[model samples]
Target chain A: AQSVSQHNHHVILSEAASLELGCNYSYGGTVNLFWYVQYPGQHLQLLLKYFSGDPLVKGIKGFEAEFIKSKFSFNLRKPSVQWSDTAEYFCAVRGSASYDKVIFGPGTSLSVIP
Target chain B: EAGVAQSPRYKIIEKRQSVAFWCNPISGHATLYWYQQILGQGPKLLIQFQNNGVVDDSQLPKDRFSAERLKGVDSTLKIQPAKLEDSAVYLCASSPAGVRAGELFFGEGSRLTVL
Candidate 1:
């Protein structure tokens, strides 16, 4: 089974502050990476995804993630975050050989100060 | 388009009791998945189905948990003699089969509590 690790379990940042969430995967193979977010009382929504093409993938809400194969890392970052960005972020992966079996990291909780 | 829909937004049951959760996937999605999300933890894939056939159930506790997606549309997951450890939110998701980069659309999830 492939395991994913998020360096920060909880993060606190003020409005307009730069944000970065670290994600690392254990599997070394053809994999698809993704970041999902869940706001309070809402279902999980897609933040961004990295398939093949470029390592840097931009997603909704001015967020992006860079896929670093050499480091086995796909870190999510944003230049400035808003209070709306306060939510639970999850990093997920699916190996091509696994028949699309998706695996998710524990998740990182982000709280944005007003 | 309508997203995945789940019933019984919340449920509470005693240990050794039986409970069931239902899911209705997107109108035309070919793949459906069941996941368990414990508090402060990520969602764990419990089972996956391709249409009406079972694709994966390796992580499911066969002795107590059973799921079936009959008629290739709606699915139901049942846990008999549920344990305390089974207390968690159950999420139902769906995706287009063979779509390598497609994201799984998730439901609001059914929260469960067992005493």
Candidate 2:
């Protein structure tokens, strides 16, 4: 079974501060990685995903993640964050070969001070 | 296009009572999923459906929980004799088939409060 681990449970940051959330998965074979975000009183939405091609992938809202196969990590990064970025982020992973189930991490709550 | 639709945005029930949540996936989507999201935790897959057949229900507590997608369009999840631990947000998601099959589009979720 595949499992995802997020290093930080909660993160506090000021406006314009750079942010990075650590995410690692325990899967040996080829896998698909995704970052999902849920704002206050909203449904979960996809932030970005990495299936193949370049290691780095960009998604909506200037968010990006890099799939480091060697490290088994796909940490999310943003050079600057705004107050609207305050939300809960979840990291998910699934094997690419078959219809494998996607496993999610505990999630990281980000609170950006305005 | 409209996103996934879920009904009974909030539900409250006493212990040992029953509750059911409905979900309508996006049009043309070939897969539907039901996930349970406890407070402060990420969503956990309770069941997955590819069309009308079940793809996975390994994490579902089958003894108390039951779900079905009869027409391969809308789905219903029912829990009989609910427990306190069953209190969570039931999220419905769907994805297209083929290359984009894994990317999920989620619903607003149905929140359940077991007292």
Candidate 3:
């Protein structure tokens, strides 16, 4: 059974603070990883994705995630957070051979304070 | 280009009732998907359709859930005799054809509250 786990349920940070959201998956085969964000009253939007090539991927709004194969993790990070960064983030994975279906992690909620 | 479109942004139904959600994918998209997102959780894939064919329905609860994509453009997801646990947001998404890593465009979603 494949599953994605988001360790942090909720995180609160002041403006300009660094942000890191942990994500781990239990799959040995090749996988496609994605990070999605949902702001208040908005639909889910793709932040970034990791297919092949590089392990470090940058996305919109100054977000980035590094895929660590050894650790089975693709943790999202931001150097400096802003109040507008408050939203819910999700990590997802799909098999490399075919994008038949995607499995998503529970989700992590971030609240940025000014 | 317009993103995926879903109707009835919100719905409130009693348990054991029936409900349906409609989705219109972006023009020329060949892949469509339905997902259910419970409060405070990530969206869960319920079904996937490639054109007019069903590619995957492994996660869908067939006993109470059914979906169809007639003509391969628009889709409908229905829940019969809905249960309290069915209270969630139903999202519809679509992607372009022949791309291995195509990004999915999601709709606003239809929120269902089963009282």
Candidate 4:
């Protein structure tokens, strides 16, 4: 079975701090990676996705993720985070070349103190 | 375009009861998805539908859970004899067909509380 792992369960940072959330997948075949965010009381929304392009992908709200094939990792990063950026983040992966199911990691809750 | 729409934003039922939730996908979207999100956890795919046919349902609990997209436009997910563990938010999402990597548009979600 394919699975995604997120190293951070919960993170607390002051405003304007840099953010990095680690994500790794357990799949040997080609994969599509994604980052989704859910603000408080809001539905899940896509942050960014890695289909088959440059390893570094930029997303909304100043978010970006680097897909490192060598490490089987797609880590989400931001140079500066604001209090509004506080939310629950999820990392998901689906198999490429096939319409396989998308698997989600446990999730990481980020809290940015103003 | 409007996002996915779900009905009965919140539901509370006792264990062993049956409950159903409805979802309406975005216009012209052929792919629909249903997910279960437990508190403090990420959403888990429960089923996926392409048009009026099921594309995937491996994670759905067949014994107690079932879902269908009758006209390939609207969908319903039902849980019979709901268990306490079934308390979670049910999310509905949809994407354009034939796209290899399209972002999903999600609804507000139906929150279920199985007491």
What order do candidates take by DockQ, descending?
A: 2, 3, 4, 1
Error of 3 at A103 (Å): 0.9
Interface RMSD of 4: 1.8
DockQ, Cα level, model 1:
0.64
Pairs that collide in candidate 1 are none
lDDT of 4 by residue, B32-115 (tens): 899999998889999998889998999999999999999789999999999999999999998775554346789999999999
**Lowest-sum lDDT 10-residue window in model 1 chain B:** B95-104
TM-scores for all candidates: the values are 0.97, 0.98, 0.97, 0.97
Candidate 2 residues B27-112, lDDT tens each?
99988999999998889999999999898999999999999998899999999989999999999999887777688999999999
Total backbone collisions for each predicted model = 0, 0, 0, 0
Give the docking tier of candidate 4.
medium
Please give, as one word, the docking class of candidate 2.
medium
Relative to the true structure, candidate 3 reaches a TM of 0.97
Best by lDDT: 2
A45-103 in candidate 3: lDDT tens per residue?
Answer: 89999988889999999999999999999999999999999999999988775455778
State interface RMSD in Å for all models. Answer: 2.0, 1.1, 1.7, 1.8
Candidate maximizing DockQ? 2
